[model samples]
Target chain A: MGIISKGEWIAKDIQYRIFEQPGKFDQILSSERQLSVEYEVSRNTIRNAITILENREIIQRDGKEYRLLPTKEDFETLEIMGKQSWRTQNNVVLDTSFETNKVQSQELMQPLGTNVRKVSYIRTLADSNTPIGIETAVLPTKALDDETVANLHYQSILLFVGKQFSEAFSEEYQQVNLEHADEKMAQLLKVHRGEVVVDRHSLFVSKDNSIFVELKSSILPRFSVIVQPDQDINTKVDGFVE
Target chain B: MNNEFKAPLYIQIESLIENKIVGQEYLPGERLPGERELASTYGVNRMTVKRAINNLVSRGFLIRKQGSGTYVKSHGVGDKYYFDLAFTNEQSNAGISELLAKNGIKVSNQILGREMIVRSHFLAKKLGLSADDEIFGLHRVRNIDNEPFAVEYNYLPGSLFANAMEIDFQTIGLYDYMNSKGAQPRHVYQRIQTLRAMEKEATLLQVDKGDWLYLIQYQSADQEGRLVEYTESFLNPEKVNLKFTVVKPSI
Candidate 1:
């Protein structure tokens, strides 16, 4: 959660690589030339990263080659994980608004006539200001505390809830499909009507399966849903019986 | 599977329709015959037919309109899954063929081409090989029930898998082949994204040009921590559903 420089991020990536490919990756750490080629970084950057690693005792200077040592498991999430981890990415929200109403009919995992809050926003790149995605989030009104409900403006609902309830949060069951751009979506996304867009629907549920949040996103073709099936879940389900 | 005695006629009729749906005899969104017609077809009474239809509707296999009767519910091509080909027999990384066969669906693959070539600069950087090293490229299209849904290309180090030029890819999975050579793909890094299909891809996947495709790119490392393979697979989204269940790592 701390802001890290590029060299620090690369250092964390090197540590993760060593853990992932435990016995073999240490050989790459033997020399600066090998480390630079292995990570596709400049020799100077690799030098900076190696100094950080050595100071942390992740690796030690031996007679000819570096020796691997024990260190705490601390790594950058986005650098180690290829393709953006949707939940962890720093999304800049733009043109956000909120509306509250009572549910008229039965909702997914919600009973009829529950009070709910809805927010619609466009996500933009901080540097480019180009619209990348549009998202709509809906949640029960009671899920929020008074401070969050009172000061609601343009903010990320996921980040808000994630900061508050980090322990119980488990994200990411996603369904990706294609949808034609509607008039409102076309104007917001700057795409012609009827053009194809990637539609993603996701759910963030609690580990105890109590709280649930539904997120629906419409993104340009530049974005795609990444799925790395958890081996633990695969074993638990035993090949998805349903 | 406890069948001590004969169940009721309606329940048996319910399972009969269920099997037909699962077996793909009655396709998704295809209407079932009317109750009167079905009762006569099965030599049953109208009430019995009505009960069977009612059971299927509640079980989510069939939908009933006011006047149109019942139709098979479409669960997006109904289990014609283009699943992960990264398989190991011991770990149960089940491939497409095993999964489809488990569901009683037929699976087949057509080998497009399998050739050996010298490594390029890109391959050398990724696989950590010297220039002029040999690499194997295998191309195939995966079909379920004779309908093509996925097109794939797998690249492997020929120095490690010299028999790649001779092994029949249709008979064994790419990961299984690697395991047979004493190398196990124990760690993998994959990226999933969407792309618009171009002319060649559109034709191969049977989708119109500009249609969206699910592009999956993977690099796998063997048990010895040597990067062994890189695969690129394009799947027609309409024909297959990619469902993901992700567990969040604690920060």
Candidate 2:
């Protein structure tokens, strides 16, 4: 994978337009005359690049005109598992409870012998009082100041923690599964006892290699979970164990 | 009337029919039982059955042919919902075709064309190459069990894969060829999104207009961080389910 030549680069640029913004250009630089003028490349270079793109099926020669190929839709729905900020969507919080306790080894990658703040709450749909989900969030107490922790009543704790720490943190790990609701969970979710539910667990890690928060959510069967990984980061986990 | 039931009779009837359609009890373009027959089967009035049928028709599940009976609408290929939770590590190195083959699924490729080209500005920046550098481009359509599922476009550095243009991609997997060339990809970056089929895509994929597709852009590099290949693949969403796991590094 050494350095590529200029013609290949231009060829890729044209291909990107077809995929990222299809049909924007009726036909990519319809003629060799337009290609040389727009791309500021020699005739030979433009011809080579266009041939490359043609070979890739990014563009096709329709008679005399070269038309860009149609691809899939461009719009994207992104859902970052753990790093997403908690916001109410047509749902009202029924109750909230906060407590402070020693950090458990299971909760953090390595217990720092420090206390953590735990926030738990239940939410229901606005139209009907039917429960939707329950969330439990745990954050290191030492990482935040007293003011930030006090204001965590009904706001997004991830945002609050982000503002407190200078280093950036992102969702590092997430696991989603279907599980039967226990008696207490069923009571909160208003579902039949032992009904199937969506359970998700996530861990957010800071840039400096600290697991700052752990979140667990149990959602009713009516809801669907969408997880979109961050594209910019190299999120490939080696030896991925389910 | 049973007051304990949460849903009304008409709504429950609608769901029953819808489930049958989804479960393939009634196939696409298959005519459904008459409204009177449905009413007697459900012990409901003709109006209730009519309403249930109307609901499905409006939702695109059923269609009423003029002067004929109601029929399940043909949703084209890949209508059945099947999801695959694909692990990136396994997919990136092994290639999707090989992965599917291992699962007892037949994978085939139709090579559209191959040619040598000079780098464009975007490709130059992406592959860390000079604008004038030569590269090889390959276009192909990938199918499973003889059904077209994905269209693939691949770009490889000519300096490393000068003989790429000579290989017959229709019979040989691209990754296998790369591995043979001692350029097996070690790292990969990918972006996945849901997209609607454009006209050309719809025709190539044999899907109707506006069918949902899974678009995956993949870039891979060797151990030394030299860009090996970049690919854009459009997949039929209905036939595939993608799943990946992310883990935090130990401190």
Winning candidate number (TM-score): 1
Q: What is the TM-score of chain A alone in each candidate?
A: 0.48, 0.49
Q: How does model 2 fare in lDDT? A: 0.62
Docking model 2 quality class = incorrect
Relative to the real complex, the DockQ score for model 2 comes to 0.08
lDDT of 2 by residue, A49-165 (tens): 887666544567899888765332111112222232333322223323344323254345544454666666665544556666776767765665556545544334555554554
Candidate 1 structure quality by residue, lDDT tens digits, B27-71: 565568889999998999989989998999999999876654677
Question: Which consecutive 10 residues in model 2 chain A have the weakest lDDT in total?
Answer: A72-81
* Alpha-carbon RMSD, candidate 1: 13.8
- Model 2, residue B246: what's the lDDT? 50
Report how closely model 1 matches the true complex, as a DockQ value.
Answer: 0.18
For residues B198-230, what per-residue lDDT tens digits would candidate 2 score against the true structure? 666678788986665666666777766677877
RMSD, candidate 2, Å: 17.4
